[model samples]
Target: MPEFTYDMLVIGSGPAGQRAAIQAAKLGKRVAMAERRGVVGGACINTGTIPSKTLREAVLHLSGYRLRSLYGASYTVKQHITMEDLLFRTDHVVRHEIDVTLHQLMRNDVDLFNAHAQFVDPHTLRLIDLDKRGTRAMRHLSAATIVIAAGTEATRDEHIPFDGQRICSSDDVLQMQRLPHSLAVVGAGVIGLEYASLFAALGVRVTLIDKRQRLLSFIDAEIVDTLAHHLRENRVTLRLGEEVSGMEPFNDVSGDRVRIQLASGKQVVTDAALYSIGRTGATNDRGRISVNERYQTNVPHIYAVGDVIGFPSLASTSMEQGRLAACHAFGVEATSVPALFPYGVYSIPEISMVGRTEEELTAEGVPYEVGKAHYREIARGQIIGDTIGLLKLIFHLQTHALLGVHIIGDGASELIHIGQAVLSLNAPIEYFVNTVFNYPTLAECYKTAAFDGINRLGGVRQDAVATSSRN
Candidate 1:
């Protein structure tokens, strides 16, 4: 066998790539990571996740949306919030994330290369230098194993005339020179909903359009219905079962206003429109590389993870995928990631869920019972003024084993983990009922829900009744 430059060569420096490189380095293997952007973190830190979430926090703080009920709906945190106000904190957060990522790579002794990388062969890569101006210097390196975590980019269609001023993608939302008086978001997916809710909180009239009749159908139907209700209350118009046929600038308007025509003969004029329909894998030409359960591509010794492989494309899951792939490459035995990890959508009223949905269980003919606790019924919920939040638990009627958990409200993302831990341990519903939680806390909902479910199972089989007591 020919001598290789490094044991592992990782492409892209996103969450997955960084984790893979660091994991291999920790194992005392020579590792190198190549990034085209000349930065340690990929689009996740530069454009997509970090920037968007930071902007969301700014909007919440400056808009005074959270205190509207207590302040009688006539209070504003700032008289006039501008684009600069929203981006001020975002810039700091991005810089901090990049610095931290770079420090991690340096401390682990992973070589960093700033260049565009392309495969010369299965075992070799060609790197085009990105730092030197106008000089086309190229370098080739071979490795024993390769991992691709190139991430994804926002999709754009030629039919849509995107001037970046009137018609923009989600990536351009953060770069706007000023806030729009009104906005139209052209997708009902996670990205679309998050941005729509954010801008709406800033007192912008937002119209969300989608061809699908429902939003986030994969989530719990009851939770989605609640989100839809809150969105409408926030003055966001939902144009479901509709599609944008075309769009053009409104000549009658002096400003940058666009007229969006729909297939349903409806017209909407807004200062700007965000087309967040979908995202494409960043892998050149071949699209997404297919991978097996081990995250290895069709070509042995080469692996792909994260958004490039699709489905549940989240930073948290991507990190785990990278670690698992690295362990497998070095012949280290490790447990696979759990099939039921949490899914979080960071909208105004966040939504999160773990395990199977009620729809899935019903379709599979699994005998299950649902227990629910509304925030309005809890003291902590009233103190925080989150009357709309809810916690729902699903359990097997026969076995009393916890099956699933769903939550929608503030801190939903963080709250879902408690239920996740219980489900992971294969614990029964009695665990919550038998335990005590701190006072004036949202976690007490678990105990409330457990008792609710137990009360519903009044006429269970005698054997099952005895099992509950023993548990």
Candidate 2:
């Protein structure tokens, strides 16, 4: 037997990496983790998820986007909310999160190396210390089992170079000194739309460009349509089906604007350009894991998970992927996940869904019925000044079982969990219809939608009426 030093070595200190390391350590295995940053918590807690979410919250509050209707457009004294306000909360939250994460790791006895790590072989990793005083300062390490959760990097396309002034990536948004009066966001994916929405809310004239015909093409079309309408209402322009041909930094244009020429023969002059389509596996450097089923690489001892592996690159799913990988690595069979999982887009008016989309159902030839409840019709939505939102429910025609739930509006992400639970349990539409939710709540929409779906199942409608009459 080859002498293995540590029982497990977790690469990356993000949510997935951290969870896997802690889980393995709890199983009485000596574990260690490699973190590129000087601090412990990975990009999720540090830059990407937490920072962006905090920025969105700050933008929502200061811009008075939430209270504009109630206060009659005079709510915001300062139309511009500074980056400091956004970064202040982000810095506080991330520091606390990192401190808590370090405490947890210390309690679990997981060694943390603040250096860049690469594969020496299948089982060995060479960690090079970033601080350079002399030539031979770094060290090498080996482990029995390795988990690759290095996450992903921003996709910097060849056409546009990020100079951090005229052009930048999502990471640069937080560190920006002055806010732009107008911005061009290339790529209408989650990251692109997120920043675009927040900036538009802050009164920056934004032009969003996407190569595809629609934004978030994989989501429920109705939900995407609603979100797009909201974005448009904020004065954000959509330039779909257009690609960037070239970009020139207009150094002569005062106040740092970028002149971009599009493939559609459109010239866009914006205060700055943000390229958000950059996404590639962080494991490209290590080359240890095969991007295969169960997230195992060529070396059986090494594994990969989260955004690095590709589709459904959500922080929520990424954490689960990490846990499942850990379970399989330790030879413990865990509960199998159902086909249905929730989707969340954290825009100003968020979007979330669970189970099959209407298009997917149609393509599969599955007979289904849909029931919709607009947020405007719901009391809670009116109370919160949210008039532009919708809840959609799909059900199997024969079985009256819940096939999917799609939501777009405030608290859509949180509200989708109830639908997720129902789908996971294989509950029928009647389950929600029979269950009475609290009055004047967003959740009541689910009940209303369920009733509508159940009624569409043909016999359920008569049966419900008969039962009601008997009662």
Candidate 3:
């Protein structure tokens, strides 16, 4: 084998890049990590997952959304929560996360290069250093293995220009100078709904517009319906199936706002407009790496993972992808990440699920049965004044095996893990039905759903047996 300078070179410092680098370091490989940001932690910590989730937590706490029913509307001593209050914990959390990443790299002895890495070839990359402390402005490095976990960036179109003052994107939301009294979110996707819900909970008049007939068409219909109801209850005006015609800056007004014209010919004026249409892989248009099934780019030694590869742009999945890419590069055995990964939307009244959607099941003509339980039937939900949440279980009719689980409401993200574990193990609904869950807990809803599924399965079995007997 030809001698290589470094064992691994990881580009991008997001969850994927960080995990890949750390995993390679654990293998005692000499590794180098290149990051564009001055901070080591990528978008997940700085502008993406961590920052948004922290902001959501603050919004939930400040708006009294969690305790509204128990304490009543008057429970809000302060009617409004400032952007500062929401962002107060962000810098600390971001700093701590960055420190942790840096510590891991230090412990693993991975060289850190705060610079932009551009491919000179599959094995060689040119690094442009922006920091003045560095004497050399640019340098070339060679590595035996390369991992591209650059992640994804928000998309913007010329037709829908972003001023950040009026029209903005998800990344701009967290860094806003002031909170808008009223906001309009274009696109009802995960990021859009998340911000719409957050701003609405904080007393902002929010209107969420989506081109789809229903929000989250990718999710189970029941869960999405429930979530849509919650958004409406929170006073978020949803304009589903509406197309955006154009946008104009609102000026000569007491407050800065944007005017949006809908395809339905309705015009809306709002203090701020957010376009969360979608995200695109951060791969530069000039990217030279060829990506394969195992995440190998055209440059055989270079690999791409996470949002940059599209599909599931989840932080959890990206972390694993990073580790696996590193393992593959190191010629180590790596477990295949399951396809039945859970999708969690961190909006208010979170939605989460694992496995196939009902549409997919129906399209494939797979015979299946569904079992559902409302939160009101669960003791913990009643105690928490949550009657709006629900859990749905989907099972294969022939084998009685668990096919999928979907939920919308509190703890949905945490709860989906149970279903994910069962699905991964190919466990049947009986596992949930027979297993005892703690009394009055949200988990009981799953138990209830399991029993419902089992009963349905039994009905199908008995009917089949009768037909066989008749024959």
lDDT of each: 0.88, 0.81, 0.83
Is 1 or 3 the stronger prediction by lDDT? 1
Model 2, span 170-255: residue lDDT tens: 76667777788889999899889889988888888999998889888788998888888888988999999998888877666375
Clashes found in each candidate (C-alpha, N, C closer than 3 A): 0, 6, 5
Candidate with more favorable, higher TM-score: 1 or 3: 1
Query: What C-alpha lDDT does candidate 2 achieve relative to the native structure?
Result: 0.81
TM-score of each prediction: 0.95, 0.94, 0.92
* Pairs of residues clashing in candidate 3: 289-298, 290-297, 290-298, 291-297, 380-440
TM-score of 1: 0.95
Which 10 consecutive positions of candidate 1 have the poorest summed lDDT? 462-471
RMSD in Å for model 2: 2.7
* Model 3 Cα lDDT, one tens digit per residue, 1-471: 878789999999898898899999999999998998778878788888889988888877777777776787446535657778889988778888889989988988989998888989778889998866655589888899999887767877678868776788887777787889889999988999889988887888999998888888889887888788878887899998899999878675476779999999999899899989888767776433346767787766788888788777789888888898888888999886667788989988888999877888999999999888888777798788677788999988878788889998889999999999989999777777557778768988877786666666555343122211101
